[model samples]
Target: MNTATIDTSPIRILRRPEVEKRIGLGRSTIYLHMQQGTFPKPIRLGSGGAAAVGWLEHEIDAWLHEQVSKSRVSSTRA
Candidate 1:
């Protein structure tokens, strides 16, 4: 008998364009949020001095959910 295993981990690297499209935010906004410590920091791809970077898909999803939750809480308080 043979068994197949499924990778259940949510690990996925998303580049800048995809991340911006998914989150509906532009490059500057993303970086601004990062500087404010409110967004996920991207991982540097390849060697040093390269401008390539990527963010984990799961982290972005989590950030999206957090934004929704914050809005809901604020609305309820009003």
Candidate 2:
């Protein structure tokens, strides 16, 4: 293990509340989109076989930006 060569950037994990607030989607809607393969999926946390899960902040941010861009493009076309 080369400690000096390791990149130490932290990844922000957004829990349900934060994710919902950021994406404007409720728990059920988020889960539904996930199942439909239309949204980013959450990552499992910890190692105790727990059911805890969260979405990466950056991923959610990208999704929101993409959605806005698509909306603008379609509205312009119409």
- Which candidate number has the best lDDT? 1
Q: Write the per-residue lDDT of candidate 2 for residues 1-78, one digit (tens) a residue.
A: 656776568889999999998878899999899899989999988667777988888899999999999999999999
TM-score of every model versus the real structure: 0.84, 0.82
lDDT, model 2 = 0.90
- Largest TM-score belongs to which candidate? 1
The CA lDDT of each predicted structure is 0.95, 0.90
Worst 10 residues of 1 by lDDT: 1-10
**Tens digits of per-residue lDDT for model 1 on 1-78?**
658888887678999999999999999999999999999999988887976999999899999999999999999999
